[model samples]
Target: MTQVKKHEAKLSRAVESIQPSGIRRFFDMASSMENIISLGVGEPDFTTPWSVREASIHSLESGRTSYTANAGLIELREAISDYMEERFDVSYRPEDEVIVTVGASEGIDIALRSVVDPGDDVLIVEPCFVSYAPLVSMAGGQPIPVPTFMKDDFQVTLETLQEKITPKTKAIMLSFPNNPTGGVMGREDLEKLRDFIIEHDLVVLSDEIYAELSYDQEHVSTAAIDGLKERTILISGFSKSFAMTGWRVGYVCAPAAYAAAMLKIHQYAMMCASTMAQYAALEALTNGRQEMEEMITSYRQRRNFFVKSLREAGLSCHTPGGAFYAFPSIKASGLSSEQFAEQLLLEQHVAVVPGHVFGEGGEGHIRCSYAASMAQLEEAVDRIAVFMNTIKKEG
Candidate 1:
């Protein structure tokens, strides 16, 4: 056999089965081209808040570079517990119910691995953060993508949940203030799932990394919902809200039973999250609220201006209620989501993620991040307008 074939055969079948993230393909493509205005990255453009960074510096200067407890520093976990209860009405015990992770991404993997048995079905709400389905697959679970719609503002409904459930179903993964779609579920909207959650007795994995970035309304924690605390594994991180993408810190708050299960895998595989990053997170909890608010205020303004520009350019878009993206329908340009994004990159020097990379429901749409500077956003909008007009003329 050929050497390439032999190497392929040596790879894990599970790893081979899953597809690489499509988001990075366009990101890499944009990186190769000069003068590309990219709205493709989903992270905040702001730097990590100063106090948070200073805390990390202080830790380093103090020689606090050793590994933390497998479950993380006691103080950081306590701060997380207190912060959740104070801000969102959700409570977890730092001693046994909260575990610091490498990022929310690691929290997700450990949580799924903790609960899922081989051949179990995990329901994923779409359009979601790109990693959810792949993580489920890697955990030996079947990922059942239960799609939400733009018409519904991408909120998962009880009816849709009902259609997908079966005896093999083991859990449901949720992301909101959702990535790509920028959709948030209100308390009333989330209340609709309470009964189904009770009846099925299913585990719920809630990824709420963008919780603090919701515009106009407070984010509703699914864990805050009655009957879900015991069943829900809540994952969030410093990356988006604190602009600490490089910190590689996040956390999970779950019932003690689930936490214990996840902790075993975490202790063996990850050992611990970065020690300095945990110290920085503790500082963020203690004193970084104002800085976060300032960043949010800037994002709110950019979102309004960018979404308005998209609508005016004749792409139908729903004003995102949360997160930093504006997903606009590009169907009018007679282009598939990939075609529109690629052609726009080539013709207008603009980089946006083709919506289908997010999920099946993302077809005919493209996700443009408003996380860039207002000047860049305005230029991107102008470029998108020119591309749209050029396509219309061609048609």
Candidate 2:
């Protein structure tokens, strides 16, 4: 009469507190239907560039297949070091300051793990990449979310950061050219944050995966600010820039002590990323700059087209300064983000991610990826306009 599930009883309370992801519910629905033009995923629509792929194939052809050092191959790490210096004016020693990670995802996980012990509070900017909190929680930290609103261009405020800080806070996780909202924090903005970090004596996890996609201004590294280098973990990768998502290569740059400690975690948990992929990423750093430039240019064109189209469709579109997403309010549509996305998919055959997938603060907003072709974006705009006008007329 009492057959307990094999794993149910032993499951920790920490594991149970996590919920199924909000972003996935919309995805599951969007996927099963045909004629759905998905502007949901943030991935580049392009394939990985030719040169990088060649490097991977070359590695395999030469039988360079084996486990790499847990921190990764030294050659690839050196390439990354040089690339960061040349591109962002950020410098780090290859031997101590960097660790090659599986993706920015792993960099995020290991970075949070390094500083957050049980009950340490992590401050996260709201409407961010959804994974940050769950990763923090899994690593035994609590996330303290600071909400940023549309009126403010969704930028985190110095005042808000000051208000949220407490004695228990360990770190603040930042994502610029951010997910969902597509907001960016320029140099002046990051300087304010750096000053706050020094005053509060806090750690910072800077997720700059979308750094390459900034349209209006240059991507600034938090570590580039003078005093913040020791305290900031810079997370970036080859995914967005070089169309290398499936390659699963990313890295983190921090001080030597942090790198060494994270290497132990990486060794035990992941061992290393794919060796061939690391070789490909090495090629990306050394040779794929032109490809990265071209994609960023295309995204800028797409960003301009889609923002205007979204406004023409009657949604209040905030021009995302970077990244391929436009986060527009669906408040006038009389639908919550989840409802709006479902109806858009069901009626107009367009797929967009509901903004609440990022957090509660995103309830009335929707994230549309403009990485699709021009034709699809036009059709999506037309469909959305009709849907809104019909709803208005009905009311």
Candidate 3:
């Protein structure tokens, strides 16, 4: 008698092929060690504003503990619509063009799934958020990296974008006031991209999660560009800007058709964003501006101090224009990005993410978040300086 064969369960190829987030891996490693000063994650260090938290508490006390509409709370959608228009001059019909998401992350996932078909190519500006390429792959699209450089202020150029475009290219994902590098695109930089995107007929998935944190210049929405609004899927949330990371509230604004497509997916996968969270988000939009602005001011000060400190510590760093990160080149240390980060963490108890994990154009550099307190930033830099000196002595 033949023995019965044992069945082995298998994950879908899509899920199986994806790697865990590099940012989380380092953060976890650092968490296990004592006295580790982690600059790995890109979360704000501030607590959620009092009014926003109070709104959520009130909702809970009022027994409003239920799921919202699949498209989210109409009140929150209207608030998001107003906030977008007033702040960025981009308007969307709240009724059908805005969908609140579990997070900006979910908005990105649904947006990619809504537009991408198998084998389609999505151009991602490199040294960007770690999730973009993986999300594209999960959506059955090919993620093609378009490298941006520090010399170019990490802004994608028409020429660079053209080099990566193919007939199969379906969309381009952009994040201004970018993560990791903290590079921001000015109007001129975006205008150069506009003609190229129009020529290629590409959908634009513009991740503006860090828009409100921009310094030196105003954050320009890609949808605010003259001809790009119709094709741009704007994804942002209260997490970064309002220090509401734990609140898990974000939203996507797009053309009615695109919004509907994403909403259908959101309906099946996630019935709605949390009811309490939506109330919190509404309060955030209504009255959280002053506190948000104060946080932005603090981040700008941290950026200046951290960038200066990194440079004085002997790393060549491009002063980031937005976000609370400084990507400093570690090439002079005769070490790869991973090596430098590892040695720095092990020796000095300071944890930063290695740049190469952020994809092309990230090698030989390290991403240090300045979202910690000033005292922590000061101590981290001193430790970094000591680490750099040890490398010099060893060399």
Candidate 4:
């Protein structure tokens, strides 16, 4: 018998079938290049507020290193409950309705896994955060894409929602103050989705991680809507508003049944969020309000300035009302989104993510983060203008 050649162990089909993140490719490439200004990552540039940092350090100094409850420390949960009620008029019992997670990212994953069964279709609003579809797939559910148009400011309409619903459609996922596009759904728009969800007996997973980053208007929570509280699982965290990205703290609020189900998964897989991060998050909720306000004010100014700069450079970009990114159409540059981004990075050393990575509706656009400093934003725009003019001239 011929000797069998050895090979590496096979990976799971579920893991292998999914494509690698499109954002990471450019981000990694930019990292290796000197003087490359990256607009690819969607993270706040601000340091975590000093008060919050001090709280975490103090916790470590006082020996708070051990895990808390699987649902997280009761104190932190109570703070989250009160904060939500005060800010958004949404109520939750800290004991049973809320669970702390590693981050809003984990909260989303568990929420989807808890509610979605095999063969069920999860309707995802795109171009959304890239994780939504992949997480739905990993949960043994079908990932159904629901595209929103740039012409409509990327808001999800009842018509668009209705057209995509199938008998298998079980739940809907949404993120606003959305990533990449920075589109925010107005209260009227969410009311439309609310009616549709109730009529169809569907559940909702609303990711409000960027809730505090809204520029033009106050952020609205779907759970506050009449008849929506029982059906919505709201996910948010300290990452965006408090600039606590590495702190990895987030919370999920759901009805008792759903919360219990998610907690089951959390107890086994996660056990608890970081104890120090929880203390830090407590500090953020209690005393970091003024710091958050100042940061939002700065982001608003950057949004206005950078958007004006893009339009002046001849890129047709919608003025985003929230989030740190601007999705500008690059169709007029006579290049695909990928081409525009790749060539710009190679030539201009200003890195941005191509829009197609966001999903089907993202073609012909690129997502540029305004999270960089004013000086960097100014230089990036200048380089982008030069690149655009070159592309136009060549065309």
Candidate 5:
């Protein structure tokens, strides 16, 4: 009989440090029970609207089901280029600058893997996406978490960037119109980051997947900055805004050389995004703008309700200018973020993610995604308020 070697006893540290998302725990628990209304998920509740779905059906019917070019279909890439230019005022050559990916998920992983050598320092602004740090670690780069201030509305400042920067720094992960906090960084912040990256010659990985979700202002693309365009990799997809998460379509746009380099890695790792999905994404870009507007409008209504009700429920909530999440402080409950989330689930039958699940600066908050229906939100709000009142009385 062969014995397993000690070095191969289990997973590597990189694999081990990359834990499963904390938000999924509630999902597992909820699936076991019926009648559990959850606002914990960070996605649009809408399905891929009819037009986009029809595109995929049409493609499959026409025998467009074969593997596409490793970088993705040219039509989809061109659509992405045109979409970016018309929406965010950013321009890139489709043939050279774009690579279609499995989703923004694959775009992120490939972009990091293509550039990160062992022990390279990657700066991540917190409280950010859970995937960024772990993905960096997986690629053998040291993940450095840079704290974004809640008081400052979770904007990543030049000051924080300066403090976290060192000679080993290779890249910074930017998730604007950010998740969890629902924070949006304006043109000023984008300009500051662009300038700093130029001075340091640092690479910028800007995740604009949530760009279409902004409420109070138009989303800014960091790649729009002059020389910074050469160093920035813009990762976006049709998932969030177009209700196409199940389609698993996204693309990365970068400088031609870098895009080429990343495409090599992506080819080996992913091969190609789903052909039907890419076709669906083409229709999404070509005709999904109206669908996106409808989703955004619904999110804005949901966001307003959640924000107003959350504060009235005794949580100090930030009225986010973008995204469909509310980063409400649960500090008043005298419980840590995890404790607050657990108790809320147990007693109130409501599930929310602990902010600390994202990173260090998120310790005292809970993230509630308002992407659910208004009726579900109202009930959750009532239950949350009653739960808080019960706790306050006990205290």
Candidate 6:
């Protein structure tokens, strides 16, 4: 009898084309080391607010463990609706236009799958969250990188959008305060984007997860801009602002039609967000505002101190207006972003993400998250200073 020859399993082209997350690669490297001060992952060092955790505990005690409706608990949706309107000036009917997702990450995934037919183009403004482009590719959409620069504070302009737009451009994914760069768009800046979206008839997938973390100005919701609401799919979550990363609760707010489309995909894929997490999120919105504000205040302070420290260390870091990251140019060290990050981790034992992982216009920079404690930040800066001096001497 002839033995059967085994062959390699053929992975889908979409999966094969995507690279693994650069953030996680660095994180795993750091995890294996001893005495490492990690400024890589963007999670808050603070614990989830006590009241929010208590709500989840009470939920478990009360035995509300069953799955919720695919759209989520109406009570949570209603609270989210009110929160969005009060906080960001965006309103939606909770009954039909809101969906509770596993995380804002899930909201993004479904939003792309719901709208992107194969070969459609989705304009992603970069340097951005690492997930954006990969998610687009997984949905069989062309991920068009519309590169933003330090000269422009990494905010996308109409000119940049115009250069990337094509007839097949179906949507534009935006994240502000952005992940790696920590850039944000003000109301006037968003109006310019609004006009372009309208002219091109593109859907807007606005990831406003960092909305409440804004330090300098109010986070103007893209959907709040005139004539853009009808086409915008707003994604946000409790992860950043509420310190609920492990809880995995987030939401999507969109026009009725878009929400319905995303809901169908969510129902089959996720069913609903965690029942306990939904309860916790509701409590967070209702009674956890003060704690959230205090966390934001702490982050703002950290951002200021960290940015100044990076500059003094001889790295040119733009002051990030929101989010807890500092995208400092590491070019002065005469090293690529990856080389700087790797050497810094190996020698100084401080971990940061290389900016090229965030896509176009991201090289020559490194992303350092300031979500660690002040003590950790101080020590990391000292180590970075030493690393800079050593590299300079060698150069």
In candidate 6, what residue range of length 10 has the lowest lDDT sum?
190-199
**lDDT score of model 1?**
0.93
**Alpha carbon RMSD to native, model 2:** 1.7
TM-score of 2: 0.97
After superposing candidate 1 on the true structure, give the runs of residues whose Cα lies further than 4 Å from its correct spot. Answer: 1-9
Weakest ten-residue segment in model 4 by summed lDDT: 186-195
Better of 4 and 5 by lDDT: 4
lDDT at residue 208 of model 6 (Cα atoms): 93
TM-score of each: 0.97, 0.97, 0.98, 0.98, 0.96, 0.98
Candidate 5 is scored at a TM of 0.96
lDDT of 2 by residue, 292-334 (tens): 9998898899889989988988999888988889999999999
lDDT of each: 0.93, 0.90, 0.93, 0.92, 0.89, 0.93
Segments in model 6 whose C-alpha atoms lie over 4 Å from true places: 5-7
Report how far residue 60 has shifted in candidate 5, in Å: 1.2
Clashes (N, CA, C under 3 Å) per candidate: 0, 0, 0, 0, 0, 0
**RMSD of each candidate?**
2.2, 1.7, 1.1, 1.3, 1.9, 1.0
Superposition error at 376 for model 2 (Å): 1.1
Model 5 residue 329 distance off true place after TM-score fit, in angstroms: 0.7
Per-residue accuracy of model 4 over 326-353 as CA lDDT, tens digit each = 9999989989999999999999999999
9-57 in candidate 3: lDDT tens per residue? 8789988999897777777778889998888878999999999999999
